[model samples]
Target: MATAGPTPFDPAAEFDRQVRTLTELGYPKLSGLAPERFAALLEPLRATALTAVAGEAAGEYDPESGRVPFVLVVTRELAPIEETMSRTTLHGGKLPGFVDRSFEPGALERFVATPEARHPGRHAYLILEVERGEEFCGSVPLDAMATIAGRGRSLLTIEEGVALITHFPQVLVKNKCFSLGGSRSGDRRVPAIWISQKAPKLGWCWEGNPHTWLGMASAGDRRATAGSSGS
Candidate 1:
């Protein structure tokens, strides 16, 4: 069986698509900005989009490591980053884009520079998929990962982490760690902050999002007190 070659990319179209996504993510404060200003803000992104990176699998999934180690973050919510990196045909796109390229070995360094580039906020967890071995799901900040790498504690390089992210497998939305709704209405929606919750296994699902700011504050205080007293 002959395999198909990579598709071509259109820079003009891909630039427009990315701008639209940023709008949905509530960026640029468009209402107050002049058209020229808004367009100017996007010039760098537009320029970056001119080049396309093809997506390819980069890391080996360890059969022995059942835990997400950091996380098995679902691909959808975390996908905008990948999409911003390459056309959907590459892997994470819902629609096609102009570029037919994949991330090269050092691609993460560039992807991190995109204007709206952000690391997805996901809980640290221990996942038991039953069919698969234990998957450790947690993430330290990028700086933390860098620090670890610099210390030579991890055989995995920062570039390797970027490769893992770029070519992460299509994941299932396994669980929710936070939610919000109006007091009178039962409308659950994404919240602004996930807040820290450390626990064994599924932290988000078990601890849940605290309902009130005061409640969260109290928890923080208690944790602080415990740390101080124990010391």
Candidate 2:
């Protein structure tokens, strides 16, 4: 059989849908609140949604190799009522509830710096906060796979990462790290796409919007290839 074509990925549309869901569920309106306050409300919700979609936390990091390494932290709680409320409201009852956690800012910076230090490819980072005080942050180290292209390791890139996200919208929750991106308005649009995983998916009590911030960039090799062709 012929392979299927790649699915269309619309970060803005997905974000709008989630915001609408949250509005319907009675959560505070994201647009009206201050940036910091809005982020605070969404963090927990993002954690719950991620856990619901990606069972167990699967992450990658190297503590000894770089000045800063990417980290993924997962937390669980007995009850996640707040998480559930956020999920149900945002996803229109399609997601489940989760425990609570908070996403540290700047977590992505650490993740990005790690791979860039050792590899020659470009990369981007996305942070997804879940409903249950949990967080799931990821880094798309573009083109770094070339370093291990023949080493038998699975090559990962930002495009592939975005594709994975397109299929599983729930990797937004889980916490544990420093804050790289400051809480600001322009920061919201830093990435081509951004996702905020909400409650009704995971039940946990906590304030702040647990969300996934998606950042994008061209792979180093791809950029170099394009530059060479143009010359």
Candidate 3:
């Protein structure tokens, strides 16, 4: 069977979808901001050039290749991380999302951005050049991190990973999930997302471990944006 191609890039449509999803999910309440204010907060990023680039198999993507693109990350400031995961769904929105019990309270908060991973530092922004790193499947995350950095690409954080799935849940297919090695708690645990019992799960794996089915997720770069801007 032939594989399907990457989803077409459409910053305008995606921005609208995200705004709608966030509003319907009651994001304004989560951010402690009025609906109008919340919408205003996202206005600036309307101009972000969410250009899509060619993706290579697991280990083949070039860190230097042209701009990589995907997803708008509403940082922890605007939307709580765990709550975002809980509100996410998969399988045509039928199955609800959940975090692993092994993640203690504040556990997700413990993970921070690695040097390789950069963001715009805004309440809400875009993550560009997103790649699932399927080529690194069966490779240890620590090894994958070194390789990704060596290539000048940044690893995807737990937030970025969640954002990817939130907008494109279809990416979490069986035997091809991804690890968020960029978000480290200063130990062995590597946050990841995968399909579980027909549902989506936010969990973790060992940095030094290798799973034939899991690859580390990464992106080309991140940009900070503000005010309402668009194509």
Q: Which candidate leads the pack in lDDT? A: 3
Per-residue accuracy of model 2 over 150-185 as CA lDDT, tens digit each? 333222222222322222333332232111211112
Sliding window of 10 residues with minimal summed lDDT for model 1: 214-223
- Candidate 2 local lDDT, residue 126: 23
Model 1, runs deviating above 4 Å: 1-12, 24-26, 52-172, 175-231
lDDT of 1 by residue, 63-180 (tens): 1221121211111222343343232122233432221123344332332211111222221101111111001123222332233334432212111122222222221112321111
lDDT of 3 by residue, 33-88 (tens): 99999988887666653333223212232222212355678888778787888877
Deviation from native of the Cα of residue 55 in model 2, angstroms: 29
Ranking by TM-score: 3, 1, 2
Best-fitting candidate, scored by TM-score: 3
Of 1 and 2, the candidate ranking higher by lDDT: 2
Candidates' lDDT values, in order? 0.24, 0.26, 0.74
> Candidate 2: minimum summed lDDT over ten consecutive residues — where?
67-76
> Any runs in candidate 2 off by more than 4 Å, and if so which?
1-6, 29-231
